[model samples]
Structures are given as C-alpha cells and as structure tokens.
Target: MRCLLPLLLLLVAASVAKAADFAARFDDLVRTATPRQLYALLYDLPKGGDLHNHAGGSDRPEWMFEILTDPARNGGDAFYTRARFGPETEPAARYRLIRRRTYEQLAPAARAGYVPLADLSPAERIAWANAFRLDAPGEGRDEFFNVIWPRRGDLSQNLDARLELLVVNLQAFAAEGLAYLETQFGLDGLVTPDGRALTPAEAAPLIERRLAQPDVVATGVVVRFQDTVIRFRPDAEARLSEIYAFVAAHRDRWVGINMAGIESDPRGRPLRFLSTLRRLRAQHPTLSLSFHAGEMDGADSHVRDTLLLGASRLGHAVNLIKDPDTLLLLQQQQRVLVEINLISNRLLGYVPDLTQHPFPEYLRTGVPVCLNTDDRGMWDSNLTDEYFTAVTTYRLSWPEVVQLGRNSLARAFVQPEVKAKLLAAYETRIAAFEQKYGAGSPTISDALGKVEKVKPVTYGYAKRTWGLEFR
Candidate 1:
C-alpha cells in the first residue's frame, strides 16, 4: 500500500506539472499570438452548441441574395426593396424587401415604384446588402429592430427559405466544430412562393424532411427550434399560447419557448407574462423557457422578475450586476444558465464596452454561462467572434473556454440522451484539441492544418478593429 501510495503521489505531481506547463504555454500564446493567429485558433476550437441563435437573424445577406436570386431555389420569385432616396423623411436610409407581383403580372402603375431584386445592378446589390446587415457606422439598435427584419419582406414567410437558411447555419456551425444548435424559429406565417400559407403542423414535417437531407445529415450537427414570441406585440399572449401548443405538438423538433423583442418597451416587462406562463404550465407542464431578461442599459428588477417567470435559461441578463439577489441566485445556486452574446450586446449598443460586460462576472461567480450567437448574421459575426470577444476582452483561461462549451451543452434543452451524447462528444473533441495544442507540442498554425478553417463574415470588422489584414 505504501509503495502504491508513493507511485500515486508521483503521478499526481506529474499531472499537476503538466497542467501548469500547459497553462503557461496557453497564456504565452494569448499574449503573443497575432489577431489572425488567435482567430484561426478560435475557429478550430470545439464550440459545443449555440443555444440562443435566431434562424432569421443568422441569415447572411450575401447568402440571402444567392438564395433569393437563384431561380431553381425560388429565386425567380419577384421581390422588392423599400428604398429611401435623399430627402426622405426617415432617420436613416431604410429598405425592406417586399413580395410584389412579377414584372409581367403587375400593372404599370404598381410596377413603377418596385424594382426586381434579380435585375438589381451591381451598385444596387451592394446597397441591398448594406441595408440588410448592421455594417454601417451610425446604424445600430433602431435599424436592427425596425429596418433589417422588414427588409427580409416575405422571405421569413417562406419555410423553404427558412430551411435553406437553417442548413447554411448548420453547415457553418459544423465547419466550426459545433456539436448542436438551438435556434429560435416560428412557422406562424410560413407560405409557398405562390402565397399558400402552411400551418405550423404542416410546416413541422417539411422542416424535418429538409433537415433529414443527406447534406444536412452529413454535417452531424444536431438542431432544434424554439418558437419565439414577439413580447411587445399586442397579441403576444395569444401568440404565446399558440406556440406553446405547437411546441408541445412538435417536441421532436421544437424544444422550448422564448420571448424576444425590444425589452425597453414597458409592454415587454417580465411580469406581464407571469400569469400567462403559469397558465401555460398548467396545460403544457413540460415546456422549457429561455427568457431574454436584463438586456437594459439601466439597472432594473427585470432579471429578478424573469426568474419569477421560471425561465431555465436567461438570455442576455446584462443588468444582472445591478440585482445582487438575482445574481446570487444564478451564481451561488447555479439555478439557471445565462446565454452570453458578447457580439450582439456590443453591436446592438447595449454594452458597447465589452470590458463592462457582466459575462466574466457571471462566469467567475459560478453562474453557468455559455457563449452564443444571438444575431450573428445581423452582426455579420458568428460563434467564433463571440469566443474571440470573450477570450480577448476578459483574458479567459483555457479551462474557462472549455467550460463555456460544456455549459452550452449542459444547459441545452435537447433530450437527455442526446445531451449526454453531445456532452461526451464535446469532452473527447476538446481533449483532443488540448492534447494537440499542449506545451512542447505543435504550434497553433500546425494544429490548424488538421482542422477546417472557415472564413468568418466578421473578419472584416475584426481586421479594421485589430489593424490586421487577411491574405
């Protein structure tokens, strides 16, 4: 026993030494690596899952153009952009995509104001992309909330377009080594190119069939949907009840319910849905809730009230620092996981200075926090951008980064069996990454060669910010 004890002690000491050496090496890389190199490393990192994605918001404008312009994939459908010229009465240049009859079908009077998206000249195409993304300097919250969404026109009203978007998002996430994705989507007004509305019940099967396609299946990225109710809408309660029923019926593909909207509006207060959610629980007791709370600039009790709303996951929780009790509940008890969207918060003008973000506070205090792409396409970013922001801004340790992935899978609303499989797979993948990138091992560049490096859409923004250009 004594002999075994001495040997065990030696093994323990060696393990500790190895860990310390890896830490030193990681810290050195963090300090010395160029933004490009660091971005490459992050791109190859195993991000377990994205739990707070919005399907429509993740649509890249370039990709959208490709999807909308291709005749074979409903691209031949006529779409128009609401263009504002100089001397317009709006705050900024605003454009929205509208479904209008074809050039041949429309009367000359009706066709006078609309321009076909397919026939847009190069300059017009650039203008359309700019209008869709939050890529402009002065464009921020209002543009995102008001202009960008409406610009999609009837695009969101088409399930096939949505399926294509989901496929692209999944493919992108898979390329970045994401094991799962929980994106918010609703089939409320989904229609065909000919304007045939499909009910949620009908849309669910089509979505499942599309997801089961060979290409999507080959990616091996598990995906589920959360029906999002626009909280500030007048019929939010009625919409909530309908989504709850839809989610209950489509539990295979739909897992949770999320209320997302401009929270600063008084109508979006957490307490407003308290009784409604309680009643919803009485009927559909198993429904999971991931509430967007505390996304405000000022300190308020919204976070506390959201907890009262019984959300298993809190999206944003930006103002949690102001409420000590709620912070303790989340941190000390680890009662719920906070979905942190660093890029979204910054780009949306909620937390402009990332250093002031409560992500590190929540993480270090033992609150289960995971990185997510809240509106990656809108931000012209993705999961890697979120990690980059968190790691660079907060100087996260390697273990902390790994724990973020673990927390993402841990808090996901996937089935228990699927979650277990995902968690196990994530552990293996991360271990391989650590092993490959450990001290005295190959450099990040060498390790990167073995993995796929997806060129991120936000690279331009990162380059401008870091003063580093890509080849």
Candidate 2:
C-alpha cells in the first residue's frame, strides 16, 4: 500500500506538471502571436457545438442579397430595400429589405418609393447590405430588435431559402470543426417563393430530404431543430402549445423548444407560460427546454422564474451575475448550462466590455458554460472567432477550453445514446488535437496554414476596427 501510494503521488505530480506546461505554452502563444496567427490557431481548434443559434439570424447580409436578387433561386421573386434621403426617416429606415411580392402588393405610391436591390449602384448595394449588420458604432438593441426583423419580413419564411441557408451553415461550421448544431427553427409559417404557405406536414419531408443531401451529409455535423416561439407575442401561450406539440411529435428531428425575443417586454415575462408548460409537461414531458433568460439589464428574477419554467439551459444569462442568489444556485446546483455568446452580447449592447463579462466567473464558480455563436452570420463572425475572443479576453487555460467544449455537448438536448457517442468522439478528437498542438508544437502558421486561407469569413468587427490588412 505504501509503495502504491508513493507511485500514485508521483504519477499525479507528473500529470500536474504536464498540464501546467501546456497552459504556459498556450499563454505564451496567446501573448506573442499576431492577430492573424492567433486566428489560425483558433480556426483549427475543435469546437463541439453551437447551442444558442437563431436560424433566421444565421445568414450573412451578402448571402441574403444573393438569394433575394437571383430570380432562378427565389422562384422569380424579387426584393427591394427602402431608401432614406431627407430628415423625415431614420438612418435605419434606409436598411429595410422588403420582399417585392409584399412590396408590389402595397399601394402604388408606397411601391414607387423602394428600389430593386439588383438595380442599385455598387456603392448603394454595399451601403444597403451594411444596414443588415451592426457594423456601425451607434447600431444596437433598437436596430437589431426592431429594424432588422421588420425588414426581413417574409424572407425568412421562404422554405427553399431557409433550407439552402441550413446547408451553408452546416458547411461553414463543419469547416470550423464544429460537430453538432442545435439551432432554433420554427416548424410552421413556411411560405413558397410565390407566397403560398406550406403546411408543416409538407415542409417536414422537404427539410429532411435537404438534410440528407450529399454535401450536408459530407459536413459530418449532426443537426437538430428547436421549435422557437417569440415569448412577447399576444398569442404566445397558444404558439408555445402548438410548438410543444409539434416538437413532441417530431422528436426524431427536433430535440426541444426555445423561447426568445425581447425579455424586457412585460408581455414576455417568464411566468406567463409556466402553467401552459406544466400542462404540456403532463402530456409531452420529455421535450427539452432551453430558454433565453437573464438577457435584460434590469434587476429581476427572470432567471429564477425561467428555472421554475424548467429550462435545462439558459441562453445569454448575462444578467445572472446581477442576481446573487440565482448565481449561487447555479454555482451550487450546476443543473443548467449557460450558453455564452461573447460577441453577440457585445454587438447587442448587453456587455460593452468583454473584460467585465461574467463568463470566467461562471467557470470559476462551477457553473457549466460554453462559448457559442448566437448569430454568427449576423455578427459576421464564426465559431473560431468565439474561441479567439474567449482565449484572448479571458486568458483561458487549455483545460478550461476543453471543458467548455465538453460542456456544450454534455448539456446538449440530444438523446442519451447519441450524447454518449458525442462525448466519446469529443474525447478522442480532443486527445488528437492536444497531441498535435499541446506543447513543443510548430508555430501556428506552420501547424495550421495561413489564417486568411483557413478562416472562411471575415468579421465586420475586424474590418471596422483593425481593417482587412491582417486577412
């Protein structure tokens, strides 16, 4: 026993030394590497999944424009962006991308005011596209919550467009080494390019077929849907019941339901649907719930109430840091995972300074957390950027990075058998990654190729702040 104890202590000491050495090496790289070099390393890192994604918000403005302007693609449908000139309208007013079908249906005078995106001059197109993103300094909550969606109108409801965007996202995420994606997609309200509504029954087979395509299959990313309902709508309860029922029936493709939209709106209070959820649970209890809570800056018990609503995960629990008791509960219980979207939070004006964010605190306090791209396309960023932000901003240890990756899949709403397989695969992939890059590895550029070549998308934040010189 004495000899065994001594040997065990020696092995433990060696393991600790190895971990410390890796951390030191990683820290050195972070500190000394240029922006491009750091980006290469992160681009090559294996991210487990993105947990808080909004499907409608996951398309780049340019990509959307490509779809909208192509007559062959969008069933000959066209789109127009409202132009602003005089003092009467807001600058954001110039940014709305309206469907031509809807626009032409408007009064002739109203229709005359907008211009086809295709006919716009090159500079005009660029300016209109920029309006879809929060690239400008003054753009924030109002622009995102109010201006953007109203402009998108029925564009997101286009079934063919959404399916195509799904493939795009899967390919991009796969290139970045993300293996799973649980994004919010409503099952209803799908429309054809010509404006005919598609029943959920008709839409299901089409979506499944697209998902089974060769390119999507090649991405090797497991995709699951969450039936998302806006919480603040007057018919929220009815919508929640309908979506919950839909998810319950389509458990094979959909894993759960996510409640989102403006949290500060009184109509969307967490408790508003508690009884409805409880009633639904009585019938369809297995559906997972990962809700958007703690998003507001106001001091309130939304997080606690959301827990009472039975959320397995909390999306953007930014304000949880403000509620000491709820924070303590999260730390002590560790029952819920916090989906941290560092870039989205910053872009949305929730956390202006990344340093002041409570992500590291959540890690230290034993609350499970994972880095995610809440709306990567909208932010003009990706999974790599999220990891880069976390590492550079928080100085995360290698183990912390691995743990965050593990936590993402571990807390995912996938089936138990699939979860086990995902965890095992993650372990194997992480082991291989560490073996390649852990310590005494080649410089990032040598190890992972040039950053500009590796990263598929260039962030607007980078372009605005540092320019495109690095890329």
Q: How many residue pairs clash in each candidate?
A: 2, 0
CA lDDT, candidate 2, residue 433: 61
lDDT of each: 0.80, 0.82
- How good is model 1 by TM-score? 0.91
lDDT of 1 by residue, 1-471 (tens): 987998989976875566566666567667766677677678888899899999999988888877776655653465665453445535332445666443356576645655667777888888878777788787789889887876676788767767887888898889778999999988888666676778888888888888889999999999999999999888999999899988998898899999999999998888999898899899875888998988999999998898898898999999999888878877777879999998888888999889999899889989999999988788877788788888899999977888899999999999999999999898778766667677426675554443335454344456555654445
Name the lDDT of candidate 2.
Answer: 0.82
RMSD of each: 3.7, 3.7
Q: Any runs in candidate 1 off by more than 4 Å, and if so which? A: 1-21, 83-86, 89-94, 100-107, 439-458, 468-471
Task: Find the 10 residues in a row with the least total lDDT in model 1.
Answer: 448-457
lDDT, candidate 2, at 421: 86
Query: What would the per-residue lDDT of candidate 2 be over residues 1-471, giving only the tens digit for each residue?
Result: 987998989977875576666666667667777777777777777789789898878887887888778877665777787864557766555657677677778898776668887888889888877777777778888888887766676676677777777788898889888989999988667767577888877888888988998999999998988989899999999999988888888888889899999899999999999999999999976789999999987679999999999998999999999999999999999999999999889988889888989899999899999999887777777787788788878888888988999999999898888888888888778665655666436665443443335554556765664353234
True-vs-predicted CA distance for residue 460, candidate 2, Å = 1.3
